[model samples]
Target: MNGVSRGTTWRMYKKHKFLFMMLLPALVYMFIFHYMPMYGITIAFKNFNFSKGIWGSDWIGLDNFERLFGTSSSFLRVLRNTLVISGMKLVIVFSGCIVLALLINEVKAKVFKRVVQNISYLPHFISWVIIGSILVEMLSLSRGVVNQVIEMFGGTPIYFLTEKYWFLFILVSSDMWQSIGWGSIIYLAAISGVDPALYESARMDGASRIRQMISITLPCIANVVAIMFILQIGNILSAGFDQIFNLYNFRVYEVADIIDTYAYRIGLSEGDFSLSTAVSLFKNVFGLILVIITNYVAKRLGHTGLW
Candidate 1:
């Protein structure tokens, strides 16, 4: 049976040899960059030594994880900030994208819709370093345009980036600005795929546009939304390192420091690779568990999930 199955698989592969050839590079890339690097995960369980290399490092069991959680309050603070920032982004930015996509779908003018989409997606292509530099200048207390306007209105200039309370707001808002348009593309595509016949039928039944949207559009796209929500849950711990790393300063570290930044600081900057790896491993394991749980819940609720 095994020999017959192997022969059948080989025959199918030969039939689509060109298609398989086209897929070869992606397979190789994943093997080299993704699968190959998975071996380094062992460093999380070792007292990783630079001089001795990954393989030669001494086995340390859970010491690195213990030190990460029990050594000080810093890790806890970092974890809190990560969750807060990521949660805010998940709730605000993700929903905003969906809303924006719906609004765009309602547009009658093709040129205007295209322009709005183009403008929205442009920022996503810009590097965080560039966006950070622009933000720093615009949010500057003394010479920023925002402060200038405040002084014009006889108001005190707010140190938005430096203040802990406001730092989180900035992170969430800036992330929305950068990503909302790009994120909406998927939703927009899903909305487009919704059968036009259903909308026509609703209109014939005297349903208003808003009513059609609620009754027809939303229900059709619920599966996509549920899948995206599950994916977001899986990434709950990764609070976008590039944006935070580029925009955050020492004064805002209390509220802005996330697990990724904490890992960079302890592992790369402070040369504690073992602890860093442990932090990463913890995040991945927890994230995977969340995905599994969320997927199960979604399936039980009669929604499509990432299987």
Candidate 2:
């Protein structure tokens, strides 16, 4: 049986040789860029030394991790910020994308739908640096358009970017704006795959457009939504580094500093490579655990999830 299976596998491989050849570059790229770099994770357990390379560094076990978590509540603060920002994005931004996708799906005018989609997608292509700069200018207390509008209504000019109270709102809203259109693309695809007959049946049952959407559209796309939600659980610790790094300043560090920015400051700025690696490892492990738990719950609830 083993011999026959091996022969069959070889024959199948030969039949799809061209397809395998086409996949070679991606395979090689993942091997080189992803798998090869995994060995560097060992640095998290070491007393990493710049003078003595990664291999020459002394293995310190969990000392790096201990130091990371023991450093005068900084790690805890950073962790809180990460969870808050990511949670907001998960709940608000994800739902916003679905709502926008549904609204777009409901539009009858083809040209208007295409234009709205195009406009929404444009912000995703813009770099965080550019968006951050634009936001800073637009939210400037003294001369920003927002402040000008507020002044016209006899209100005080509020510092949206620098103030701690408003920083999280700006971060969440900016991220949502940048991502909603791109994120909605997946839901739109899922919506398109939904059977039109379901809608037709609901309409014949005297269901209104809103009623059909609630009854037919949402249920059909529940699997896709579940999958995306499960995938997002794996990123709970990430918290959009580029966006935060580009936008946040020292004034709002208490509220805006996340794991990624904390790692950057510790690893690159302060040269504590081992501590940084330990922080990153902790995040990856925690995220992995979250994904596993969430996926299990999703499966139990009879929804599709990332395996």
Candidate 3:
């Protein structure tokens, strides 16, 4: 049976050899940059030494994990922040993108839709470093635009970046602002594929544009939404490292630090490669588990999955 399966697969591949050739570059790129680096994951199990290399490093078993679980460890705090921030982004960013895509689709004026889309996409291309500088200037304690407006209304200057609750608000709202337009591209594409007859029928049934979006457009693109949601669930622990790192300071670390930033700080700043790798390995493993479970639930609920 296995031999028959192999023969069938080989024949199919041979028929599509040109297509496979086109895919070869991506396969090689993934192998070189992603798969080949798996060997370094062994660093998580060893007490790494510069002189010894990965293979020769002393075995530490679960010692590094013990430190993560130890009292006085900051792991829990960072992990909590990661979850909180990611959860908010999951809700706000997804809704923002979906709504933006639907609204843009409803617009009959092509020029206005294109202008709004271009404006929204412009921010996604901007580097977080530049965005950080812009945010600091816009919300600065001294002479910032936001504070200037508040002063105009006789309100005191509010330090937004340093406050915990406000910092989280900034993270979620900024993520939504940066993502809404660009992230909606996929949904918009999916919406375009929907049969125009469906919308016409809905209109004939006395459905408003909003009703058509909610009843027809959203349901039509449910697969894309499910797939994107599942893919993002796998990165739940990540929580936007560039944004948080650029925006957060010592004052907001208690509320803003996440697994990636914690791993980066420990690995480079403190020179604890093994512990940092262990932390990363744990996060990846958990993320993988989350993906599997989420995919399973999605499939059970009659949605398409990554698999």
Separately for all candidates shown, the number of backbone clashes (residues 3 or more apart, or on different chains) is: 0, 0, 0
For candidate 3, give the lDDT: 0.92
Candidate 3 residue runs with Cα over 4 Å from true position: 1-8
User: Which residue pairs collide, candidate 1?
Assistant: none
Cα lDDT tens digits, model 3, 2-99, are 99999999999999999999999999999999999999989988999989999999998888888888852799998999999999999889878988
lDDT of 1 by residue, 1-307 (tens): 9999999999999999999999999999999999999999999999999899999999999988888888857999999999999999999998999999999999999999999999999999999999999988998998889889998999999988999888888889899999999999999999999999999999999999999889998899999999999999999999999999998899999889999999899888999999999999999999999999999999999999898
What RMSD does each model have against the real structure?
1.7, 1.5, 1.4
- Tens digit of per-residue lDDT, candidate 2, span 28-66: 999999999999999999999989999999999999887
Q: In lDDT terms, which candidate is top?
A: 1
lDDT of 2: 0.93
If ranked by lDDT, best first, what sequence of candidates would result? 1, 2, 3
Model 1 residue 9 distance off true place after TM-score fit, in angstroms: 5.4
**CA lDDT of each prediction against the hidden true structure:** 0.94, 0.93, 0.92
